[model samples]
Target: MAFGQGNGLQRQVISTLDNQGRDVMGLDTLAWKYPDSSIVSGSLLTVESNHFCVLKSRGAVLDVYETGQHQIITPDKPILGNIVQGFFGGNSPWQYEAIYVQRSKLLAQNKGIATSKEMAIMEYTVDYYVHVDTKDDAVKLITHMPFAGERIPMAELTAYAGPVIEQAINQIVQVTPMEQINERIHDIIELAKGHLSEFLDIYGVHLNDVKVLIMPQDARMRELISLRAFGMSELEAVRMYLALKMADMGLVSAPNAAAGTPFQIGSSTLGTFDVGATAGLPK
Candidate 1:
């Protein structure tokens, strides 16, 4: 029962198939013929038979010795990290450093014998945080936080936040036909409001779970809500609003909004707000 950590409690059988569809099962025989490829350390090499060989690495297996028809098998390794390269420093991380050292020691103990793939997976938890030059760099580098990981630093947080901010800005400014831009601005505001409401619903600590009567009409309060909703600075929201307004007035369209302007819906604030403002128009 060969088992690897993170893969949970399950047994796996590594067997090779010969041309006649016979199972060739012997670790010693496999190791003798198909010496592990040195290009990648900790790769699994198994002899399917005298004529065929299989190599397994990461969670994937490949039959390279079969020239005309090669069989590639992708195994399900439960403990494998989702964002392997990006999470760990591309391919290597310090957390895995200890594993490598331990593996070396084991090999030395066994007089430089090849270790199993399952052993490699357990020896090191693919370090997703390796490429981070500094604590700040780490925050920026992390795309999705693991189930229970530590918080990233402020500088990295800023780096991560910058692109999303830019994207939001671009969405606001690049509206064709000034009228359409104004409508988008209103949409953005509404979206911000909606997000805030959702946030409050999720974690608002009311008096013993009693609902807090927070008014949505208050300007500063609304701004705060918007900031939290979009996770952007107040200044960014303001800039987005202004850009949308500029688009509404038939001013120069932002570069991203070069496409034809969309139809505008009449605002409630506009005089005699009517649903029929542009109704019955062809799509």
Candidate 2:
């Protein structure tokens, strides 16, 4: 499964083996489309979970878990677009306005810009606008428009966009079925509990407060705890756990709790132990 936002919309493509084991591809055409978009290229495969992996050249790979549900296996990193220089030859104000609106919306959706300050930069800068399409047969035209002296770096643009994207995601997650939401919540809590335990042991924070800080009425937290209780691997539990936590904390949001990178514990390793011992018998 590869998901992306481009040309002011979102797109999802699913690839699977056909009945005879040949590759089959499916897509949602209503999603965004970018002409000349660079293909994800690479070869190394990284396993994200039982249901997902990262393919070298492709983006994330999802494991089919239940009907209409998939475990996402991808990083939370933003994809950068190649910059090209070009001019739109036209004299029509309406066409220019359309192009500007489309470009601005695409940038906002993809880059995740949210702050008033950031938006101002985008709105006041010629560098951000680049060109305006005028007529159907204007051919090509170039002019030495004065540099507007204002620009947002690509990195800054991505940072600005991240939280906005997250907020949009949370809105969607809020409407997901309670059963699935709870499962993911439990998974996250369990991972956080483990991390809290370790952090307490190492830095000497009290266990009582750790529990309180990580426990609440959040459905995603509950699911993480359940995953831990069920003997899921620590890494698996943690990844699902973190994704949900980030979602809850308003850091990033995905369609479901299973989307995004696994939790990254600095130095903990999984051990073969009774789930009861590590997770504490389910409450």
Candidate 3:
């Protein structure tokens, strides 16, 4: 091809990537429609920083470019687009799609209610961030993202992530007791990260980090656990709780037991509380 002819096609067929247009940063667009569906060989393809351009022919990823200008070619194109245009009398433009994708790290928040193996219900929240792992992963992400223009909304990424988070919570809660759920949340977070990374990896998405947030359905269950941790038996904890409630109700007076008095079931003081020196009694 003559240099002047190449320049004419370059100038008339493709324009320099303009940052002032739809390709600007911080857009929610996941996939963008390349202006020209019929791409001629040697047309300039520009991809800005933190972005990648994917070329697809007949629904197969043809080429992937990152943060640079690239040219579309016929011989090197994948799928049915690889056919030499020389057969058609001259170099011909091929029908293809060039989609731009964001490569910046993205944050996703998800929530679900998990039912434990013991039938305990727990509400859990998960937050994580991800970015394209490689050229292969970027194409995989586009399967769900499609193109709004030039940016893929983080919401769509996270929306698909919700189910993954929910499944992780279910796996963790199934074996954990309600009373221990709070304490196990950290471990559950790690486990959730494992599940998410494994699942997203299929689409070439890599997990950067994960955080698990949980609120036990029963706060009272947690309180009872704390009381038991203090060396109080379950039955003792119950009685102590009852005594405190009754005292607050003014239904019983504070303990003033005699010296050396054995603890009585009817006493107003808890069995664990110190009764102190017997009042009005001989030493």
Best by TM-score: 3
User: RMSD in Å for candidate 3, one decimal?
Assistant: 10.1
List model 2 lDDT by residue over 1-283, tens digit each: 2322222212222223234543221211101111212322221122111112112222222221221223233332133222111121211111100000011111211322111211221111101111112221111111111112221233333343344333442333344443343345444334434543343232111222211111224455456657777776665676566555546767423212343222233564333223223221111
Q: Flag regions of model 2 displaced more than 4 Å.
A: 1-150, 175-274, 277-283
TM-score of 3: 0.60
Model 3: worst 10 consecutive residues (lDDT sum): 1-10
In order, what lDDT does every prediction score? 0.28, 0.28, 0.63
**lDDT for each residue of candidate 1 in 153-173, tens digit (9 for 90 to 100):** 223322433343334323433
> What's each prediction's TM-score?
0.16, 0.17, 0.60
TM-score of 2: 0.17
What lDDT is reached at residue 30 by model 3?
A: 47
Better model by lDDT, 2 or 3?
3
Question: Per-residue CA lDDT of candidate 3, range 1-283, in tens?
Answer: 1111233123223322443454344544445555555565666777777777788877888888887667667543342233444454334445577777667787778877887667966777787888785777888888755554544666766777788788777877888876677778878888789888988887667899888877656766556666777788776665455445445666432232211233445654233333233322222
Q: Number of backbone collisions per candidate, in order?
A: 6, 29, 7
